[model samples]
Target chain A: MIGIVDHGMGNLMSVRNAFEYIGAEAKVCREPGELAGADLLVLPGVGAFGDCMRNLRHRNFVAALDEMVIGSGIPILGICLGMQAMAKRSFEGGEHEGLGWLDADVVRIRPAGREYRVPHIGWNDVTFEGNNPLFADLPADPVFYFVHSYHVQCRNSGDLAATCDYGGTVTAAVRKGNIFGTQFHPEKSQDQGLRILENFVRQGGQC
Target chain B: MLKKRLIPKLQMKKSRFGNRMVLVTTVRFDEVMEIGDPVSQAKIYQAQAADELVFLDLDASVENREPVTDYIRRAAEELFMPLTAGGGVKTLDHFRMLLENGADKVSINTAAVENPELITRAYEAFGAQCVVVAIDYRQDADGREKVWIRGGRTGTGLDPAEWAEKAERLGAGEILLTSIDRDGTREGLDLETTRRVADAVTIPVITSGGCGLACHFSEGFLTGKADAVSAGTYFCFKDENPMQTRSQIRNAGIPIRIQT
Candidate 1:
């Protein structure tokens, strides 16, 4: 069973449903005990970075998640703001500390020039960087839906699994051992997103 | 790089902006008893490759107009896509509550027109990108188009083109313009009205109402000049599924990229 951590951000049901849609037995759990029963864990969010961190801490999920990914070696996936929270720090609403699992920082993607919008909303292609089980079955550059202002910039380029050009090359997906994160919503990405989830489940969620 | 979206609008209710002639009301949400749950509805839409999930609290005003902040919170808790909540939002407090709950975007309709300053205030509070001005329009007696609020139940003296420009100036990041005349009719879009607004503003425009078939989406994009097209009736799960319509549009070379 895959355990989806219920942090108080949006996009919980869709992730759960997507798992169910792919025939994966997934459950939404806020309890750490639930983590022990699951082979894999999924963390999803769709709001501000600061609020997501606070909610994770408030629910006592920070330590539980850390244990699940680092201590217990359980495979984990983070989506959108969930991905941002995995970085070392975020500058969303002032500087806030992140999970520090990956040596990265979440910063706003300002339009360098021209008329690129702030919140890069809509569909964009994801170009694969290296061989990863998470993107199995999908095209190397499939268009996935994205909506966000702040994006994660990995300190070590080796951690990036994929990159999508929004204003420029933005980190779209990252994988470090058993821990993986996607900046876009696979639940909302249609077949490509669904296929990625299916691969994540099939790989038994390993590093 | 932000790729432009091709949205299909779905109306949850009938046209209330006096464009009753061109409208065709269908199985409303309340009437669809078999529909399991709102959260489930969002999940299904997501599974169907819906880029984003938008839920308009259609009955909020008729029953008791409170911000659907709880619904937004609950939906966000379940949905993986960026969620947008509309309907019965009247004040900055409502917008703030919706944001606090989990809405990525707060759509304002009657409230913004009822108190025009609400536009500026919303922009001030949440930044321009977070604000979307949802305008419903129908032609008046003199053949001059007029803007409607309160789910097209109330009409404001402001013209839609003027309102679109004003909204941009007031710091609105996007516009969701629906045509009361073509709503539920499935005939097509209110091309002239939608085009006027889209041409008047520099911000992206999402056209809603009167999407009967796949070609309607094309018309909205090519003729209406909208950045996105949103439809409710055409995309509902009741009788006709939306995936078919989406493919038809894509097959016609509309450049719509699905999840796969």
Candidate 2:
């Protein structure tokens, strides 16, 4: 079963609904303790990075999630702001400490030129850097829905899994061992996204 | 590369049965014509590789906030495309209710004009990406663009370009600009107003209302500089879908998504 951890930034109904649509059993767990039975945890979020981190901390999910996910070796997939929350820190709305899983920081998107918009919204294609199971059986350079101003900049080059060309090369997906993250919302990216979520769900069981 | 989107708009109203929401088509932004069930049409769009799906409830009023929440939940449970729902949304509570139900974005038309502050509140509550201010406008006798509200029944003395700039300043992530003059006429899109609004706002603008030919969508992108093109009557009445339409756009040297 998949556990969708809610941190109270916005509605996560679509996350749970997307999972159930793919013939997977998923539950919306408000508390960390409620996720005990979940083999894999899916951290879904929207809104600002600092606020999402605070909500996770306030819900007492930070420490418990560290213990449950890292200690127990269970896989976790972070989407959008949830993905940014996995980084070490963020510069959005002042500095805020993240869950500190990946060696990265979230900062505002400064397009190389002024022609590109701040919020890189809509379907942009992704380029897979290395062979990873998270994007298995997908088409070459598949497009996914993206809506964000801040993206992850990894200090460790090995952590980079996929990147997309916007105004510049923007980090689109990342994976390191049991921890995985995607800047795009797979739940809203149509069939390619559903296939991605399914890959995560299946590969999560093996881990 | 962010390709231009070909959106299929699902204009909705309560069925004559008054129980289920059905797909609708509009002319001049007032006359409603029932097409079919939303789910069936959505599935067809999904098969046809539609870039996204838009659901607007035409019958929603301030007193009777009949949003397409139930249908949205049902579609969200079945389909995987992004859903943008709006119409008669007047308060932040209504915005929260729709997002919680299954809508990816809540569009405010009447409220965005009546109470512009609601845009900030909704933006603060749910990010600007969730707040899409849909501006319905028609030309006056003096050839001035007047913003129309309550599904074009009430008119406000606000220019589409200026109102769009204000909406963006108030934290609107995007603007859905519809031209009531050429709606359902199949003449062409209102490139003049669309270009004006697109140049006014930094955010993405989706031009709608007049699209009889697939090449018109190309014109919106190449000439009007619109980020996306949304149409209800063309897709509902014409024998075209996103696939054939996108093919025309691709053949016209316009960058559109290569369907998977």
Query: Compared with the true structure, what per-residue lDDT tens digits does model 2 show for residues B57-161?
Result: 888863466565788877777767778888888887788778888888889998889899999998888888888999999988998899988878888999999
Error of 1 at B3 (Å): 5.2
Residue-level lDDT of model 2, residues A18-123, one tens digit each, is 8888888998988988998888899998888777988898999999999977898799999998889999999987899999999999988788865476577889
Question: With candidate 2 superimposed using the best TM-score fit, by how many Å does residue B215's alpha carbon deviate from the native?
Answer: 0.2
Worst 10 residues of 2 chain B by lDDT: B61-70
* Docking quality level of the chain pair in candidate 1: acceptable
Question: What DockQ was computed for model 1?
Answer: 0.24
Q: How well is each residue in A58-157 modelled by candidate 1, as lDDT tens digits?
A: 9888888887789988888898888888999999869999999999999988756434555666788778888998877776458887767788999999
DockQ of each: 0.24, 0.68
lDDT for B148 (candidate 1): 77
Score chain A of each prediction against the true chain A by TM-score and list the results.
0.95, 0.97
Error of 2 at A31 (Å): 0.9
